[model samples]
Every structure is written in structure tokens, then in C-alpha cells.
Target: MLDATLKTQLKAYLEKVVQPIEIVASLNDSAKSQELQALLQDIVQLSDKITLREQGDAKRAPSFTIQRAGTDIGVTFAGIPMGHEFTSLVLALLQVGGHTIKLDDAVIEQIRNLDGDYEFETFVSLSCHNCPEVVQALNAMSVINPRIKVTTIDGGVFPKEVEDRQIMAVPMMFLNGEHFGQGRTSVEEILSRLDSNAGVRAAAELSKKDVFDVLVIGGGPAGAASSIYAARKGIRTGVLAERFGGQVLDTLAIENFISVKETEGPKFAAALEEHVKAYDVDIMNLQRAVKLIPGKIAEVHTASGAVLKAKTVILSTGARWREINVPGEKEYRNHGVAYCPHCDGPLFKGKRVAVVGGGNSGVEAAIDLAGVVQHVTLIEYGTELRADAVLQRKLRSLPNVQIIMSAQTTEINGDGQKVTSLSYTDRSSGAAHKIDLEGVFVQIGLVPNTEWLKGTIALSRFGEIEIDARGQTSVPGVFAAGDCTTVPFKQIVIAVGAGATAALSAFDHLIRSGDEEPQTTETKQAVAV
Candidate 1:
């Protein structure tokens, strides 16, 4: 089921193959095996350098293997590869066909220096945009380390394993049979975990730093932009983020970000990191600022018990999805309720799901989920949908989508294990109704990440930072941008612009106050990290 454009691209990529890849599929009585076999056949048929063969009986199939140049790569796929995971399959093929690895030298060295036998079992859904990055990283690492085996299981294909593992999200990596962290993980992050003597270091703590020229408190688009801009001005810039990429990682399709026609969230997030890494900024990932001190030299206290000092600070902590805190909502998370359609949509393929709220986010999620899910029931508390007209029109055009306006979600019904249905109250009729579904996606409003700055700065009732035109906060040396601020619109382009403005303002303040000083290139370079 390859499209014309994709087929052409794959053909071009395969033409460079110097070696043959033999796919060994273990058959089973289940239809999934037959479907996977058909897909493998189609892929092998497209290239002369590839071959497919069955290994085990239909009744005893458990695994599949691929061999390149007569050597097992130690790679396996436990289920059908589709959705976002399709990239993983393609990349695995390209690697098996002898394409040179594109990893950094340091990362490759890390992979080659590994000591013990490490088997990584990465659980992923076909729809998770962030899953492929981790999967491909592990797959590439496997190419270098024979002792390292990687098994990729499509969480959607085997629901029993998902429940057994208590998997709440995709890219839930397991190393040596223990749970590793989830979400978009980088190569260096994984190396740290494997090297940890204790349990996988949940997060790397930031060391105490004396002072910084510009300190950014978030890792989303705004924080990344601020750090890059400030560092370009020849100053010490530091970014402390709970998780890099912020809310942008939760987004699915981004057409409104200007210049780029289309891109997924996780892809864009990775690009953002790459772009920021090009500059000399000290990026402290997984560090959450628990407290803030405003003065000529602002101080940030992180949850890891490190105190960071800076001359100027920029807040770009970003926002999170507003949860519908009804009965059974929290308990059923990942069981049958999810907030990100791009991350979890494929897991509910051929199953009915519901979308809560009718804002732009909610409607967009419904439209996105409708393509993969069997049915989408959109529930809005307002009398009419508040989404953009174009999004509303597109959502209405979907045959499997149903709209329920002016209804309040009362309780989330679950089978004590997974979400089974949702109950709501009809505002007009004053009647309660229930909709049976396997998954529920919440896409209401966004709660700004200004809770830590409650008494530190001026915040709106919604918890957004109050910033003037210059992006300056109530505190003189502090500024804010992105969704955490009271900006008119919350968009990627706007956040980038706001970040630039905040950096410029911080530079101006340093110049006017005579706190700026010319430094040697060596000193400047040292602090850039």
C-alpha cells in the first residue's frame, strides 16, 4: 500500500544497496501474519536486492528475523509495521542494505564501547511520531553491537502485552527487562541510562552554576529560540528545561508555522534541538525550575536541588493540555484515555474513540483521529463549536465523526482496567447520555506553566505571565515568552518572535546598566557550553 511518491523515494534509496537483505518471517494462523507477509513481499518485490522467506509453522510463530550479507542484524518486528512506525521499517531496510550509518562519532563510539549483553525491548504504536526516533536509534546501535538485540513490538498489534507491561505511552523503552523513560529520547540519553550503575538514572541532575548572561527556563520553541539568540550575542546562555521541545512535542500536524508546508510534532522537535545545538548554549535537559528569585541577578532553583544564577532570565516553560478531571479520568489514562492523537491514535485502530472539547485543538484531534479510528464522537460543552471554521468544516465532512455540543462530561466510565465509555449531561435537555468507546482524547484548553512564578511575577488569572511589548516581566531583569506569557496568540512563529524580542531586551538592559563587558574568545567559548 505504498503511494506513488513514497514508492519512487524508496526505489531511489534502494538503488544504492550493495548487499542483499533476507527477511525471515515466522508465519502463524492469525491474519496478522498473512498481512505482514504480504507487506514484506510487496517491499521485497520492489527491489532486486531484497528477499523474503517463511521459517516456522503457522501455529508456533513467535518472531521474525532479517539477515544482511549472511549475518543476523539482531533486529526483529513483532507485529505489522504501519503508521509512523513505517519509517522504522524503511530505515531498518536501508541499514540492512548497507547504507552507511549517519550517527555522530561520539555516539558510535559509545555504542561500540558497550560492555555487557543489553537487549532493548521497545514498545511502540504505529501512530507515535516520536517512536521512530528511538526505534531507529536502537536499530542503528544494534548494527554496531552484536551483543545488543532490539525487539520492536507494535503495541496496537498485541494489546495483552501493553496491559501486562502497564504501557501508558509509546516508545516505552525497556533495558535489561526494566522500564526506561518514555517520550522523545536522544542517543546520549540512552547511553547515560545504560552506563548507570543503579537503576536507570530517571533524570540527570543539574550542577550548581554561579552565574549566566542569559538563562532560559523552558525548552520549547520559545526557550530554544531565546537561548540561541542570546548566545549569538556573545554571552553565557543556559537553558533549564523539564523536557525539551515543550508543548510542540504534543502537536500532530503543523501547517500554520509559516515557511514549512507540513511537519509532525516530534520531527519538528528534533529539528529544534538540532538547531539549538548548533549554538553555544548550555542545555540542561530534565531540570525543572521549582522556584525563581527576581533581582539584578536572578536565581533559579531546580527540583534537583541545584541553584542557578543569571543576570537575565527568560521564562518559556510552555503549557500543558487541560485535563477533564471527572471520575475515572486519571485512573484510566493510557488504559483507554489519551491526550495526544498523534502519539496514540494508531493503537485504537478500528476502535471507537471520543474527543472532549470543541476548540481548535479538539476539532483537529477529531479530524486526525477519524482517519485511523473507527469512529469519533466529539463532545463540546458550548452550544456551538469554537474551532476555526475551516477545521469545523473538515471535521463535519468526516463520515465517522459525530458532534455533541452543549454537553458536560460528567464521568469517565471504565472497566477498572481500561476506559469503556464516557457519560455526559445534555445542557439543553437536562438529560444524561453515554457513548461507548475504547479511547477518549482530551483537547480542551491549555494551562500555562506559571505556577512556580505565582508570587514571583505578575500572572494573569489563567497563569500566563504578564509581559509588555518588549517581553519584559514585572521584574526588571526577567522576561517571558511563548504560551507561558500573555501573548495575543499562541503559535510557533509567534513564540520564536517573542523569544527574539526577549533576548534583544535582555541585551539592551545589560548595555544600559553597564553590566556588559568584552571578553576573550576563550572565555566566551567556555561559557557557551
Candidate 2:
């Protein structure tokens, strides 16, 4: 199962093993089990310190555990850890073999101090871009605290468990057989959920932070760029974000990023975070900005009841997938409604589904889902598909795809627990119709994340932050960039350039305005002009 180049890389990585480790495989007489055995055998050949053992009887066949020779520090993978999870498997091997985990020292200590037994089971699809983070996080915790056991299950491999649990989403997590969460989650978020006092402690710590010279309110490509540029100017730079990488984490294939011919979203996001961390920027993740009060020293209030002050604030909160606001849509979000086709398509294998849109994303989703699903019904509000001609042609060529034009999605019909059909209105005929299906994939455009700044600063009619050519907002020292701003394009490359401009504009404002006193209403209006 291992290729020539992969074996060489695996050998090199395994050489870092400071302690003996064992790969205990739980297998049966099945094709998947045979494949797992071959993979484990290939791994065993790479290092003398590594050993593999097979056990016929186990809860999940074709599964394996990577554990220290004599210790319980380990993590389990119930399927072939390839694709996006390949890095996760390698990290588990090294960390179990006594290699250091690349996490904060305080976080490791907190994991070790956790009191109870926490068994985490995460269901993921190999195509999912968001699964690795959650798997790696839980695996790291298991390594630190033996009481915390993590089992990553491939939804494609074990369809029975997925159906039994009613899982229609990738990276669906369960704690002790109960639903914990679904979608992208971080180690800090998991910790905050488990520990009651974690939020209070974090809030208190943030409240005591010194005023920043340049504080970035988002952590996407734009925020990363702004932080790097500001920090390079020898200013006190800080970043506050609900999560790093922003919408990029939800993205799958990204081939448009210049210099890099092709790369996955998660990988590119990691590089962005790594590049920012190389500087002296203080990154505060998992902090949501609730209110922004502009002044000479701007005050940004977070949902955790913490107030962070800064000389200049750069908003790069970015945008999110627009939801189809129809009845039963919110009720069955993860049950049958999904936004990402790459992540959740496998879960709806062989089931009929509907794609609600005719844009590029919608047509692309229909094409992708047609391969995995039994049938795909594409509904568009416009008379014609707005997708590229090539994409539209490919979608039309699909045998199991159906397209409906001049239709508006009326409602998503579900059976209380899961979606069963979708309702739409024929715009030209003035008639309504419902199609039977198991899932509804909404691929409408995106809405900017600037709701908090509505009353605080100038915003476009569409809610995007209003900014001048220099990336300067109407609030003088305050600036905005990326998808949150009035920037024409929402591409990552454009966001990076805008971030640089905003950072430089902020520096210029700082030097010109001076650090004397807070701006009065009269002076603020004058600066806006």
C-alpha cells in the first residue's frame, strides 16, 4: 500500500523515534483488513524500534493503534489513514514514540491535569479538509493524558456506524457515545467545552493584556498578512480570531493561489499561520469580537466579556457560506443540510440529494455529488446557470443530474430527524414542486462577517466594511481588509495585498495622528473626510 517515495519519507520520519513503539492491528478476513495489514507491515520495515502485532477480534476490524511500547499513550485509527489524514497518522506515530508535540506548554499541562475518562470518536471522510485538525487535536490530548482516548473512524469504511448514529456530516464527534459536535473544531475549543472554568480563565487573561499597537480582528489570509506586516514594523501586533484560517478551512481544492500551482485549503491555511507565527505577533485564537468601539485607542469587546484595546484595529473577519433561509433548513442542519460537498458527499452515498443553486459552486457541487450520490437535482433561481461554460457542460453531461431553472427554493422538508425532500417554486409557471431526497446542499454565495461593526463604522449596503483606496475605514485609525471589506474580489491573493495596504495605512495614521489623546467627534469626522 505504501509507494516508493512515501516509504523513504516514512523511514526518515520514523528515525526520530526516541522510544520503542508498537502498532497493534485489529483485523479480520476482509479486503480492507488485508490492506491495513500490508500498510502496517510496510511501516514496521521502516524502523527497528517499531513492531506490529495482529489481533483478529476487536470492536472495529481493520483498525490499528499506535502506542508506546510500555505506556498507554496512544491513538487509534479505524481505517486507512491516507489523503488528508496521512499527516495525522505520521504525527501519531512520532508523538507516541516520544517525539514532542507542537503545542503550547500550558495546553499540554492542562490536558495532563484533566480528571475524567474521555473517549472521543470522530467520524471523518478522507476528502474532508477540516477533519485533520480535530483528529490531530484529540490524538495529541490522548498522548498527553492516557485517560483521554481518541478513535478516528472513516465514514466511508464503516457505513453502518455512520447510519446508526445518523451522521450526515464529516468530522462528527461523539464523547462517550453521545453527540459532542460536528464540523471544524480546535483543541482550545475542545478544552473549553470540557473544562467549565476554561472560558472564565481565558477571559481574565485577555482582559489583562497590554494595549496593542496594531490589533487584527480576524485570522484569515488577510489577517495573517496584516499581522506580519505590522509586526515587521516593530510595532506591538496582536491577532484576535474565533479561529485561524477563517473560511479557508472549509475550502477544499485551491488551484488559483499564485506561486503554488495547486494545494488544499487546510495546507495553505497552515502555511499562513506558520508564516505569521514566525514573527513576534501574539495570536489569540477562539476569541469572537462582539462589539467594536472606535477611538484613538479602539476597544473591541469579545463575547467572553473581555475588552481588548488597540491603537489601530484591522478588520479581516472574512465571509461565510450563505444559508438558504427556509423552513426545516435550520432544524435539520447536520441531519441532511450541508454546505460543503467535498466533506459531506460521502456520507450521502447512493442517496438522492438536491443542490440549491446554479452558480459555479452549485454546478460544481452537483457534478461532484453525482458521482457519489444516486441522483442530483440542481435548482437555480435564475433562468440560466451562472457557472462557467465548461462546468455547466460537465454538469449537463452527468447522467444522474437534473437541472431546474427559474426556480426559488421555498423550503427544506424533513421528517423531524432528517431531511426527506426539498420544496421549490417555479418562477415562470407560478407553481410549486417538491422533490424526494435525503440531503440538500446549499451553495449560494457568501455573506460578509461584519454584523458587529454595523453601528460602529461605515458599512456598504451589503454589510461589507466601507474602506477607501488606502484600506482606511471611516473610523480613522480603524481599517478593514479581505472579504469583510468592500474589496471587489474575495480571492486570497487580493486579500493578502489589501491586508498589506491596510497595515501600511494604519502605520501612516499612527505616525501622523500621534499618541496624544483620544479623537473627539469633531476630529473623527474631519479625519473621515
Candidate 3:
């Protein structure tokens, strides 16, 4: 080991010469060069990391605590954090650290009262700068809660550590020792996870199994609200959804929703999730309802190979985004390429952004981004913008917004750090043009969130589960509403209304079937003195 004197001597000597030339010659000196390289290698190791992975109180199972030093809840990134992943992490931290999003004051107050610690150690390669947003969001969330901490481990330097953790991608997070959800989870979703973990699964599982007063089939807006309302009615309610929030989670934004006007689809979905959890409703997310045998006790078959018995079913299966299937689009989503500008546009503030498709959503995204970002590039495969005339006129009025009609997205350009630009082919010119931008939002349209329910429920020609005005399906005891349903227009207000209607209608059905004996799984009762 070099003594302090030798280290000072080396520093002095190195300061006098240009680094590159000196490094080459000094490295020629076998012993010293080997020593220098070894020292650098060691310094990069986790043990020598300037910042450390957090260790919470350990007592808090459902929540984690953050370690704070000052105003800035010190976060250290060993590598460049520049892409969508980094942005998300930052946002998550901001929310966790008391950064309020575009939510109402009431919602903000409710979230502010939440306290927990989170530590995310995302494994990333030097080439994956596009993933910085995830870290950034996490850090932002940490700021909301002083207990949250997010760290990044350079995969290039620590492949063994990543392998030991079984990390298969550029990004992953672990809460305590157990693996949490994957990909990019919104701040609200992460909070929901913490909340869900707080509820004892066994205690929550103690719902009545024999006879449900109300049965909610879907897990979207309508189903979530329906179950909540019904359960709040002091009646037995059971909810089974492929996933909670149904197609609402699939939505990119809910600006059209009354009173909200602007919010991310996932964040908005999380707000609804908070409402769902505020009640004693039985939730079965990520389980599809395959078949429904409507009768006194409707037997619903699930994709997980489990049969569920409910009194009435509310189907809120949502829709899926229709993809262009172009190469690199899926791989680059949220990595510089995105589908929801509302969810990601803020990251590109004063930076360049892009939007694909000629529909209203695309046009609106472009317009929305134009105001916040430095440049807005719009791509459409058609000869002209297909949005309404007013939107077209406004788009034309914006100097930063470029309209590229008849140009189809052919390829996305990136070094895998983040998307640097996009390449498109112009049918009229038989040529292609590449423009540098930070993001790409696709607005081609979406598939009804009802594909998995083929034999389970009646579906319309558009793949929407058919529903009545009261959100009831063809099956007497089953109901559905929202984007996945046969609602002509998929809007936030409409979905909320449909969800409320389904809840009320399901409650009424349960009341009408009073002949059936009710059941309870509760064993605890007060002693009659």
C-alpha cells in the first residue's frame, strides 16, 4: 500500500503533466501502473461506494425509512442518469419526499400523511442512460418521505452482484430483501403497494365465502367503485378482477375526467386504488375471470386456474394499446419512446420531444409538449393530420410543433441509454428523415381490454364487453362498465359514472336476492355477559 507521502508525491507529479500522455507512460512502469489500476478497481467496488444502500429500521415490514442529512436527502448515482427510467426514479423520490404531483389538494394532503421508507437499487449499464428517469422519480418520491432512498449499481462493474440478485434487465428494485414489482412503477402505485402490504393478507382473506351480498367482476374504474360503494353499504362484497383498475390502468391519461382535467393514467389509477382500499372490499388483481356461470351463486373461473364464487359480477375489463409492431418501438417504450406524454412530457422540459400518429391524442400530446419542451416533432403515416380541424389549426399555429404527414415511424435511434432520435419514411418522397428528440408517443388507438374474457362474457364487435345502461352484461347477475365495456365513448367522467352505477346496481341485485342465506368468515364475536 502507498503511504500518505507517496500518494502526495504521485498527486504532485501527476498534476504537472497532461493526464492522458502521463497515464500511458506511467502505465508502462509495471509495478506502479498495476498498483494504480488495482486501486481504481477497488475504489469502484460497492464497499468503497461514496454512498451506501440503505438499511431501514427493519421493524417496519410494510414501510421503509429514509436516511436524511440535510435539505437534499443525498442520493448518489455512480453513472449517468438521463433517460426515462432515471426520470421515473426521480419522480418517485420526489413524491416520496413530499413532492406533490398534479393531484388535488385533498389528494396531496392524504398522501402527505403517509410515512414510509423505500430503498431501490437499480442495476444499470453505462449505456443505459435512458433509464435515469426511473431513479430520478424514486429519488423525488424519497424527498416526499425522508425514509425513502434510491441507489443505482453499475452493472458493468458489478456483474456478479447483479447475477447474485438474479437481475435480468437494466432496472430492478428491491424493498428490504424481497423483490418488489418490476419495470417502472409510478409513485402512487408504489404507495399502494406499501398500503396493500400493511393489510394482513390473512385478515383480508377472511371475506365471506358462502354468500356474497354483492359481487363485482371487473377491477377497473366501474368495478373498483362499485365494490367500494357496495362494501360501504355494510353488505358482503367480493371483487375479482384480472387486475384492479381494469382498463383504467391501461389509459395514458385522465385529463378528460371531471375535476381532474390532467393526471397520469397510472397515477390516476392509484388515486382510485386509494379509494378502493379505504373500504373493506375483497380485491383479486392480476387474475382473469375466464368463465361465469350466473345463477344463485355465480361461479367465475379465473385464469389462475381458481374458481371464484360471487353473488354478482361487475366486469370492468379494460382495453390495450394497439401497437404498430414496428421494430424497436416496444423495446424503447418509456426509454425515450413513450405512449403517454402526460406521464413523461415533464421530463423533457426545455428538451426536444416527439409524438406519433395523426389522431387527437397524438395532436394533443404534441401541443401539450410544445408548451413545455423546446421542440415538438409530430409524425403521422397519413397524408395529413387526422385530428379535428381546430387541433390542426392550433398545431399549425405552434412554431415549435412540426407536422410530418405521410411519414411512418420506421426505426428508433438510440444507443440504449435513451432514444437520441427517430427515423421515418415518407411515402410521397420515398425517402426517410431522422429527427433528434427525447420521446415518442403513439396514438394509433387501443384494443378493448376484453380479449381474455372471450368465453367468460358477451363482447361487442369492437371487442368491448357488452354492458347495459346500468353497466350490466348480458348475463343477468354480471355487470361491466368503462373502456373495456361497450361504452360508446371512453372518458374518465363516464367511467366514474359507470363504476358508480355498477356498484349501486350490484347492491340492489344483492338486496333483491335476500332469499339466499348470507355467510361470514369472521370468527371473533363479543361475549354476551
| Best of the candidates, lDDT | 2
The TM-score measured for candidate 3 stands at 0.58
* Candidate 1: tens digits of C-alpha lDDT, residues 1-529: 6767878887887787777888888877787877887777778878999888888842224446666857867478888877787878888888867888888786688789889998888889877778887888888888877788888888877888877876756778888898766777766667766766312232323444558989999999999889888888888899988879988886777888888999978778879989999988888876789999887888888875677889999999999889999998989887787888888787788889999989998998999999998999999999999999999999999999999999999989987778889999999999999998889999998889888899889998888999999999999989899999999899999998999899879887887777887657986676443
Assess each prediction's global lDDT (C-alpha) against the native: 0.84, 0.92, 0.61
Clash statistics: count for each candidate: 0, 0, 71
Per-residue CA lDDT of candidate 2, range 218-275, in tens? 9999999999988877678999999999999888889998899999888899999999
TM-score against native, each model = 0.83, 0.96, 0.58
Off by over 4 Å in 2: 516-529
Better of 1 and 3 by TM-score: 1
lDDT of 1 at 526: 64
The lDDT-based order of candidates, best leading, equals 2, 1, 3
Off by over 4 Å in 1: 1-23, 28-54, 57-63, 67-73, 93-118, 141-148, 155-183, 187-210, 397-400, 427-433, 518-529
For 1-529, candidate 3 gives per-residue lDDT tens digits of 4456645554443333211110011122345334434433322231111222222233211112222323445344433233333344234333433334554464344345666656666655443332343555556555555466666655544445654564444445677667775554444445556665422432244333556667676666767777777776666677776556555554554666767768755567668778887777766555556666778777776644566677777776666667777777777764666665654555555778778878888898888889878998888988878899999899899988888888878888876656778888888988978898766777787787666678766788878888878777877777777788778887667777888888777766766767333333341121110
